[model samples]
Target: MRTPFFLILDAIIFIDVSGCQWRLLPKEYPK
Candidate 1:
């Protein structure tokens, strides 16, 4: 499925703020 750029960006921001690993991101989020 083609994911939205903003959603990916938001996910990145959320991860950065939360200090979560990239691999920890859910499959639904950006790769």
Candidate 2:
């Protein structure tokens, strides 16, 4: 199943604001 657009977008923004690395994101999230 495909992930939700907002969920993916939120993940990216969260990482950006937190200054976290992409590698830190959960594997379940999109690439």
Candidate 3:
């Protein structure tokens, strides 16, 4: 299944705020 737009946005915001790499995102979110 494909990830939702909101979820992807949230993940991006989280990464930006946390200053973490894309690979570091939680498994629940898409890579």
Candidate 4:
């Protein structure tokens, strides 16, 4: 159903934002 599809999309967006935030930090900074 549409609800399930939207839930999956929301999860993917959350993951993408976390990854982008990590990548955006200065490379010299340790993880």
Ten-residue stretch with the least lDDT total in model 4: 22-31
Off by over 4 Å in 3: 1-3, 20-31
Worst 10 residues of 3 by lDDT: 21-30
Decoy 4 TM-score against native: 0.67
Better of 1 and 2 by lDDT: 2
| 14: Cα error in model 2, Å | 0.2
1-31: candidate 1 lDDT, tens digit per residue: 5569888998889979566555466654645
Q: After superposition, how far is residue 29 of candidate 2 from its true place, in Å?
A: 28
Query: TM per model?
Result: 0.50, 0.49, 0.50, 0.67
- Residue range 1-31, candidate 3, lDDT tens digits: 5579889999889978566545466664545
Give each model's whole-structure lDDT: 0.70, 0.71, 0.71, 0.83
Per-residue lDDT of candidate 4, residues 1-31 (tens digit): 5798899999999998788778787664457
Off by over 4 Å in 4: 26-31
lDDT, candidate 2, 1-31, per-residue tens:
5579988998989979566555466654557
Cα deviation of 31, candidate 3, in Å: 30
Poorest stretch of ten by lDDT in candidate 2: 20-29
Off by over 4 Å in 1: 1-3, 20-31
Better of 3 and 4 by TM-score: 4
